[model samples]
Target: MDALLILSGIVVAIIGWLWLVITSLRLPVGKLLLAALLPVLTLFRRDQGYARAPRLLLTAGCLTLLVGLAMLFHLHPHRFEKLVTGQWQPDQNRSQTIDGEIMGQRFRPERVFWRGDDLVLEEGPSERVRRSLKIRFAGAGALLDDASIALLPNDPGAWPEVIMQWHVGALESPGLRRVTGQYSLNLDFAPAANSGATLRLHLTLPSQHQTWITGEARLDQTPAWLEQVRQQQSRSTAVRERTATAPRQSGERPVARWQAISVLAVLDEPSVVGDAAVRVTTVSGRAHEGRFKGVTDEGRIVLAQAHGPNQVDLQFHPVDIRLLETFQSPR
Candidate 1:
């Protein structure tokens, strides 16, 4: 992707230069004369077998000159000044910070570190947010944007939660916003323990809002993932139990009570109410099932009485939505 983008940029630049040469006399005539002389000089070097080195050098010089001129006219003065002065400010659109520890598996057992800074944007009652981070591995050079990310409402009353999707090549160097890089493995908060494994993480959140939680974590016990699963299972089990005991009403079929069920997966999709679904499965063995209702005030699935002695009410937490989606998908 990087090569393709660079190639495309060069092509566009060449085309633009051709257009300018055809239409304008302002092309730096001195630079153009020097560019024109390089190839002629190459032809005189017969001992070098008329090697194309001169042409390559001339082409590079021409391209650099064109790009320099373009930047003079197109680049922002203030931004250029910052670049020259070696000082830059973080974009201040919206603000939030996340700090956390990240651990990964490896022989000789080592840990990776994580830190992030994010911008938040508000649209009337809604909010839009973006984040960037730096991550370091034990033996590897530092990697940025190593996943531990979340967007919560800065407004204490809302306490809204939104998980940002990880995209490769999202982090930017602090000195040059344009210099961006990619992340190799994007991980969420999940705990796992294994032989030949170790974990390390260091994170920084850039906002004034207080972060909800932070501490040492393993891949196996990611609190958010686990808590969400637990809530979904509890909700599903409660619904099943109520349905099992509910007496059948006239012309009504009793809902089946699922057995030894566990949440298998979840997905969050855009919705009028909210975006997410919870997928569940039985511990004994069976295909996964889905629960489509939104979360309740207490963070459980919302359920209504359908008839019989089993009818009950319920709600679920944000995690259930992801579990529901995964379970519903094949495998």
Candidate 2:
């Protein structure tokens, strides 16, 4: 803990001590400075000694010092501690925990620690053996994201991810269960004990609308992998902040969330450039077509233009629309 954080406690103690000396001992204003600077000298001043201070003032001073001392010891977690850690197991007991099937998973985590938008949780030594139902997470943003990509089948995203993998004895390996298909995800987070957090994840593949993972993960610890991830996220945030705030040179536009330009370059046919396209019609009955890229949070319609292998997204305000039609790829 930083001393600067608890510095006020120390200051309060000193101020309270001085106040007691002046009020209780009735020290002259001129001699108050001497007492404050060298409280040890009070022992020789019989009339001004602490023994003469008021009982109430003495008690208040002692309490202040005790409070300050406790703060100095830094008994709480650090400010940066934000990770959530704890045990993760299947809700097999039908305790009304949702798809809480498959009981008796990994041993309860030994510890959970969190720091700075990151968390780590490690199960009791049991996950080491060959038969435990183990689940591990490896992503930044204090939640799952695309970066946790692995070749494993259980995980998702544009690349490979290890989803549900089971290892058993040479001939006892069990077939993977409830682990198939791409999915859409939803998460609910709730605060837990010791500054930890509980993550409830629900996944369903759009095609089948079937649940893949209805599980809970509690995190509150420092993990080696998450440490690297946390540092990277911190550095990225610093860089982005600096870039957005740096002084702009002459003629440089201030940063904007979205922008448009004139004299746009030409592109290949929409079918050749992208897998999806939208034709938007204005109230005036005029239509414009382009590759569809969905709509932005600000209600701006996004279209894309392919320049060989590269692409750019174009935006349009929603007010301009009278109708819109779209075409999407099956793949």
Candidate 3:
């Protein structure tokens, strides 16, 4: 029934278009094009006799087109909703980002987004990106629930955990699979002049074979309420807390705590220095310029040299530093 109405509508609309064009051929070039667009314009022809049949046919075609569309909506009431909200194509949302591994086949994905609702990661050519990873919240997950994109939990302790469903692999390669397991998002929503944030995506998909969907993606977001979140954070007298996974056994590498790097030194503090470009001269008389990452829990100075997106942290003991100088001229 649906197909029939659609086909009929197509046929009638075309017939009306052709009928108008055929009668306007002898007219001027402008009139010919005008008649093609507005078939009803043919009714104004000085010769009422020639315009009679085409005018009636055009009316019938228009009515058929409207009726067909009406019936289609009646049959599929959700049609209108889908047109407004449904994704017709993978990148149909205009904004797209991808990161992480899809069934261990691992490739590049645009990783420039952050959201708690319908967070999609796309990788590979257009088609496979969506086939790679999808993350969605079963409940309202946002610091500012009304924020543009769901702002990651600002409480520092509030984590949105869910049984996430991910399309782990492609159908042909390694056979398509689904991993349904515990998952959570850890976001560091520090105040910045930019629209991106650092986040850690933790997933337990069982077997640990591609346990995590896609590589760790830097999910960036811009919410109008970000400044509000920053303000609220500023008012609260609490330091952001970090959680360790478990007690480290032996050779297992420790999970790095995802923390915001804030300036530890003001011009007033002449003793300690951090969070800016600086030259560090060691007691061994070796000097290097690097940016400061916060000290590790074990009291090691974390100096980092940034190369594009990656930062290489060179650690040092506080006592070994001979002097520290900032690129800024002293005021």
Judging by TM-score against the true structure, name the best candidate. Answer: 3
Q: List model 1 lDDT by residue over 1-331, tens digit each.
A: 3233334555654554444333323335654443344433433444443324434443555555556534632433333334456655643532222233212101111122232221111111113112222332222211111122222223111111222221112232212121111211222333234521112222222332211123233332233333454456567677767766878889775453323323321223224323223333322211123334544344444422222322222233345333333212222
As for model 1, its CA RMSD to the true structure in angstroms is 17.8
TM-score order, best first, reads 3, 2, 1
Tell me which of candidates 2 and 3 scores higher on TM-score: 3
lDDT of 3 at 330: 29
TM-score of 3: 0.30
Error of 3 at 11 (Å): 57
How many clashes show up in model 3? Answer: 8
Compute each candidate's TM-score over C-alphas: 0.22, 0.29, 0.30
Q: What does the lDDT come to for candidate 2? A: 0.42
- What is the TM-score (0 to 1) of candidate 2? 0.29
Alpha-carbon local distance difference test for all models: 0.32, 0.42, 0.48
Cα error, residue 120 of model 1, in Å, equals 14
Worst 10 residues of 3 by lDDT: 146-155
Q: Report the backbone clash tally of model 2.
A: 20
* lDDT for 44 (candidate 3): 64
- The full ranking of all candidates by lDDT, starting with the best, is 3, 2, 1
